[model samples]
Target: MTAIALKSTLWSLSIKPFKRKGGTNLLLNASDLALGLRGIGWNWSQVHLAPETRPTSSKTTFVLWTLASLCLHIPVFDALHYAVQSFGPTTFGTINGGSIFDDTLSPLLRYSRSTFISFLSGLVIYCAIRITYDVATVFGIVVLRQHPTQWPPIFNSPWRATSLSQFWSKRWHQLFRDFFVGVGGVPMTYMFGRIGGVLGTFFISGLLHDVGLWGMGKGSDAVCMIGFFIMMGFGVILEGFWRKVTGHRVDGWIGWIWMCTWLLGWLNLLVNAWAAKGLIGSLFIPDAQRLPVKIFGPLS
Candidate 1:
């Protein structure tokens, strides 16, 4: 009986789309439209809230974000060192001294003295850069008495409390998710079912992340990028399944799980940063060393 029910559900989902010609395209287009509207709505909301809190002029915000972006890159480069050093000496030879490759194990292993030092250096540099960006952004907002949302030309927040959802929804790369879900997810869901919608969204996001990394001359970063997509895809499928089984929605548990996962991932990254520093002294500094550099380094 259960098997038959499962088969019936699958058949219904798969065949229904074929029975309606052009329906898939139509639904997809609708999703795209919905996403666009959502984006506009979010932007409008930000604008509406902006005047009440701070200056309406976004020029100063834009300038700060631009500076923040440049500063952010310094740590990103340092993070890359840990990622790169994880490949070890053999991979280095294979790449002709170029720092690129997908080696998952190096980060897991105990570090040598030199490797540790380098990783620590890189980690410190990265942390310093990140801290500087955060502090500067906060100070600017407070001094100008301006709303951070009005800050344009910036993609993400420098402060904490930013979640994946919130970050996607408001702070960093606003409307990107809306556009993806609107353009790809909603349509795919209607045509192919929720699974399709989820997968479609995940795939597009992964592709974009990969492209961004590749554009930065970090093509080897694809491994982690792909891993991220896989995780998200699984997450989507699980959420859908949970909803179906419960005959309603499942968010709180899912949200908690997502947060836990994100934190764990971040912790691992931090550990990797420290390990990298231990393995290669001065090659990278851990997050701890970020402060002094930000304070002492040349200020823009």
Candidate 2:
């Protein structure tokens, strides 16, 4: 089975230890190993024919992406985020550099606003990333003159996701998928069962995310983020059951609603906790008078 194969691969990676001369284990922070393995430089040794045309433009892709990033960083992204929270029954605003948890708002309204802001945040981020990728890739083709034998896709229309499995495997980016699989998913699948892979992947991701949250001053809310991911793992399991029982996965508007209920709806906890702890503040530029950068920004 696929799980068995993954388990074997994980075992092999575990036993085949490689260490830096300075005694650092890159595996400890799996990102390093994953990046190294996935980087084009690492795989370029393989034989491949170069593309016939290596083209780049100054005005089209790169310029547009730079402008988009500017808009998101300057006005639109943070402005929209602030407007959503303020427009709601509760402001959830920053006061004296802290989050004011206004209780005047109804929970339904609060959740709705949170969902809206999160949606906007996600949309801006997606656009930013896509544009950034476009800029870098075009730069490579034109400036670096590196001919891509085959260009990998930037995304797979994540909105079309019908199930958590499809979302994770197909819709979502695969950059960190290998990290979870190699680090925990495989062993978990072997020890437990099919669901083990799901749980293991999610839990490992949760820990990583918790670390990130803690770093962002959300140490108090890190547990919420971890729980959020574990909940997603469980949701994935339930989706699997739905497919088995109904002879189809949740799809169409129903599927979208189901996915959003858990993914976006459940996100309220993490975002609320994060907002309370001033963690969300780290994400955007300060009010018009300020910017996202700070003293520790370089190190962060």
Candidate 3:
């Protein structure tokens, strides 16, 4: 099958069960449970075009998807953040302080420092929460398979892959990526190249996220929205260069570069967390408590 077709099949398979009774199965067929499955599947397949997947006209489907996402996301993100805090060496204070430095230099330098720092802090917190949720899910899946009753639903399986690209493809929100691919990927690829396609997809995804968060009165989310775009842009350029140098095949030195790229992406989680914490504390903490802040300069 073609790449788009394969993506469509995967999307359909992943979301089909939600349309069924009890939302417990993955098969797709004509049934009351599949009420909005067609819309979801068609949208993912690029067969249906709408301003957005959650059309205003389909109040029922929109509500269902929103509620479902909330239920699933809340617990997962909470646990993920908890895991990082409890196990990771770095503290939240350090992360907030570090983020300040990130914003001080970003395009937001034109904006108020306080406002930029505040938004960056919120983004870091949100990302930490998401990471916690993902990690907890993985732990849950592994333990549950051997002793189902011993583990509560508090955690879930980690995504299916360990690498950054794999994580992007499998662990992160599939619907979000699929929607971007359908809406923007083809045009970007046609206009620029594969690198442009990836970067454009991520950039638009960031903007969409920012707009949504802004509309909901959460201006802080824009930090993450912008951060994602920047990171993805850098990644796309790096990947393109690597592909060209490696003759489109990763082997020998090319493999090493690829591995390093993946490692750098994962390390960004810690780097970003540090930057965010640094930024937040700089704004809220008192001068007396600012010694550590100054020493770390926002990444303390």
Give the TM-score of each candidate. 0.42, 0.66, 0.40
Candidate 3's error at 57, in angstroms?
A: 35
Worst 10 residues of 1 by lDDT: 43-52
For model 3, the stretches where C-alpha displacement exceeds 4 angstroms are: 1-164, 215-224, 248-300
- Candidates' RMSD to native: 13.4, 8.8, 13.6
Please give the range of 10 consecutive residues that has the lowest summed lDDT in model 3.
Answer: 146-155
Model 2 over residues 173-276: C-alpha lDDT tens digits?
55446657666677789999879988888887777666655665435555677788788899999988988999987788788778877777666655666566
Better of 2 and 3 by TM-score: 2
Which lDDT tens digits does candidate 3 get at residues 1-300? 133443454456574442322233243323212332223323223222222333334434444444465566554443333333322225333332333232435655523443333343334455544445334434433433212221122212222333334334443434355546655565688899877677777766666655644453323455565576657556556655766886663335545455445544433443343344332222333534544434433332
Q: List model 1 lDDT by residue over 63-116, tens digit each.
A: 555456657766565555444444444433122233222344365442343344
Show model 1 residue runs off by greater than 4 Å.
Answer: 1-175, 218-223, 247-258, 262-300
Sort the predicted structures by lDDT, highest score first. Answer: 2, 1, 3
